[model samples]
Target: MSPELNAPGISEEDKARLTQSGIELSMQNRCGSYLQMNQDVLHAECQEEGIEVLSYRKAMEKYDWLKEYEWKAVPKDKDEITQYVASQTDPKGYVIIAHKGTKNILPIQACLYLGRETIQHVHNIIIAEEGAELHIISGCTSGGHVGQGAAHYGVSEFYIKKNAKISFTMIHTWTENIEVFPRSASIVEENGVFLSNYVCMQPVKKIQMYPTATLKGENSVARFSSIIIASPSSYLDIGSRAILEGKGASAELVTRAITKGGTIISRGQIIGKTAGTKGHLECKGLILKDGTIYAIPEIDGRVVGTELSHEAAVGKLAQEEIEYLMSRGLSEDEATATIIRGFLDVKIAGLPEALQKQIDATIDVAEKAGF
Candidate 1:
């Protein structure tokens, strides 16, 4: 176990909460880690040779060139959430940089813990230099004692250089009283690849986010996948967008949403702006108990040679499917859970096995709860 995990302030209950959010406190099989409690950065370190992990403020002070990348992908004046995070004179977040040609067999872990702050805000930047490969797992949660009406605002920007690749997986476990707003964007250079996966099965008061990516170099690629469940008191509005601007560039956006007496709005968009570029968007939703699941998918092709397509479906589980499972000696609840599990199972191509297992474990929790 890392000494930081056993640090004085973190309690057993808090550790359990972090674990549910996909945080590995032991630091086993992790190449780097960053932890922030409320608005304070508790720890940030890198174990790999060619990677750099530091607090946002420390990164800015260490590298002057970092200023050019800050807010370059995500505009500060784009929305109120971005403005709030941008106005913070003393920002709180972690910056991870993978140097040229570097790769980590194990993924980095980032944790954001909301404790007592009414509003916790952060600005994060990630950069993958040419020929580098970076993988990160981010866990966001709240302390057991956090009160209602707490909110979190975050802004993240990613830069993938030529021939580089970056995979980021994020898991959220917040209390039903907390609200979250995240503004994020990314830019992919020539031959670069970017993969983003998000999972949030826990209850939250309200959450809204729409992340965008721009593929700017020839043969660049971007893929985004999200799995979410909205509980009775939760209201989730999530979406993702991709713009293919380079010749031969491609993008894919996929989402799986489930509502258990809550409200969920799943959105996706893809724009093909260059010749030979291609894009696709897909969204599938399921309503369990009189909840709302709304899906919005959009695809735009600007040029004659560009191609774009979208598909969205929102409905309940098929009774015949559930009955078919029950005939195999399973109970009604078990059959329903099995079908829901299969519905939420979306195998993402090119994702690391370790990250895939982490995502599976998150969904397994919801399945065990009979979702």
Candidate 2:
């Protein structure tokens, strides 16, 4: 084990227990292996059977862009934002640092698995040089066994160089006592493209996040898709935003959220500030029992040829839709489950079939969890 796997705030024995229990409980039957993080440390990392991200130091050496944006993801304007920056320690979270023009798929998992009261802060970085392409599947979960409650605060930043393409899929399955806050952003240079998919169909005590992407070069593109399910007593506030700051840049933000006996605020926005820029925002919500469901979608444009649009809707499964599914032989419970599941599915283009199918199944299970 390297020094990165030594969790600073946790004892060595607890680290071993957390690492083993976390991986075993949350990482079964997913990818071959994982870059695991127990709380704020690099608990363990190993190459899966087929996919790999080269060592962090090797990736830093091979990519010139890493130097330009290292540790520059968090903005310093807000105290709340800068507070997370202050919590960082070396090797705070697993990293996916790829060599220039490299192509690979990475599967990663990071969590605080200890059941005792604990606070975990993490920072994850991804760098892709010009013409490089990568696919990533990342899952974050908390094991609420002995440490009944834990707080996970993380920041992620991605640097996508010219012509580079990155597809990111993030899944969150946390316990009711776990509160999550992930602040993430991406910088896409000219002609670069970034596509992200987020799905959280599990029950969590509370979650609040609003990640953004900035298209800073001409012809750059930013796209986001998210699906969330909120159960009884669960409070989720999730948002996705895109900023088009270069001529000819484009962006899209799409989100779907489901609430059953909980409060869910679904938000998305697109801001186009340069000439010839275009963007759109969309949010759709399904309320099963509902404490509250709010969908807020906004779009703003400035300068010539800059166009923006948005649409938002929040509602429950219509009786007719549930009855129609029942006509096809599903029981009442199954019919409601099927409807909720389909409502939360928002397909992302260019996603691998295997991962997409897996995400689809995860959504179905999450959406019906409270039903």
Candidate 3:
């Protein structure tokens, strides 16, 4: 376990930094030098837990993390972005799954590092064998605050085999000026389950992204969840997609948008392409001050043998509900906070225990400020 793992209230990002520092300390004390990128390096520390570490330069070759892979894949190399992407073509972020001859019960962990303030673009490819289970956590943040135009684009793709289980959690809270485009996808096989959670707590100016997970196997399942808070002058366009292509496949999405003087565009979709698939999309928005909040939700089914459901709701705090709370002698802010908490209680309940508590605290703060 990394040092930050034991620290209370520390974020997934801080834990990643500690893990990176620990790896460096181990290499220097045991191997005599810090690990460097762009060099083809592989290690077999343990057969049960296969581990690999690829430097930022090595992860950019196949996966362009600095720019939107499918959304904005053309080219924008003004600030050494192109050079950084070129460096990682040799060996993308290291890969370690079970050997063909052996099967393991432990999930492999990958620790990615951003040792500089320059814009980083990283691409990663992970494959889990039949019946394998892996929990991969990717962390992105700058080592220090540099000048403007310092950004990072991270794109990853995963392939989970039949009966495999994979849980990927990406937490981002970088400098206020940095821009990030994080794109990811997973293809699941029969009886496989994939869970993806995208949590944004930072206040950024401009962001555009919509990560997706497609369930293409029978009895496969996928869940897409997000938590977003928009402040004054900030703009964010974020959403998720779940597509079911086989019988007995299922998908569900839930999103929450909190806006105040800023604009947020949320688009969620559930598409069923074949018979016997089940899918649903739910979008709920909270307009604190009503700068501008647009909620566009779509559910499309091309086959008649499937069940697809979708819902879009936009509104302010309920007047009657607020009045009822205020009648108990609480102030207006307190009443608004009470209603907002009740609105988001169920959503927070489903989050990971650690993250749920953090979100609850944030909601408490938001309520005090008339959120």
lDDT of each: 0.91, 0.69, 0.59
C-alpha RMSD of candidate 3:
7.4
Candidate 1, which ten residues in sequence have the lowest lDDT sum? 1-10
Candidate 2, residues 113-202: lDDT per residue as tens digits?
Answer: 434567666666777678877667666665545245578777778888888888877777677888888888899999998988887776
Off by over 4 Å in 3: 1-117, 142-147, 346-371
Model 2 TM-score (2 dp): 0.83
Q: Say which prediction, candidate 1 or candidate 2, comes out ahead on TM-score.
A: 1
Clashes of each: 0, 3, 7
Could you tell me the TM-score of candidate 1?
A: 0.98
Ranking by lDDT: 1, 2, 3
Better of 1 and 3 by TM-score: 1
Best by TM-score: 1
- Could you tell me every candidate's TM-score relative to the true structure? 0.98, 0.83, 0.71
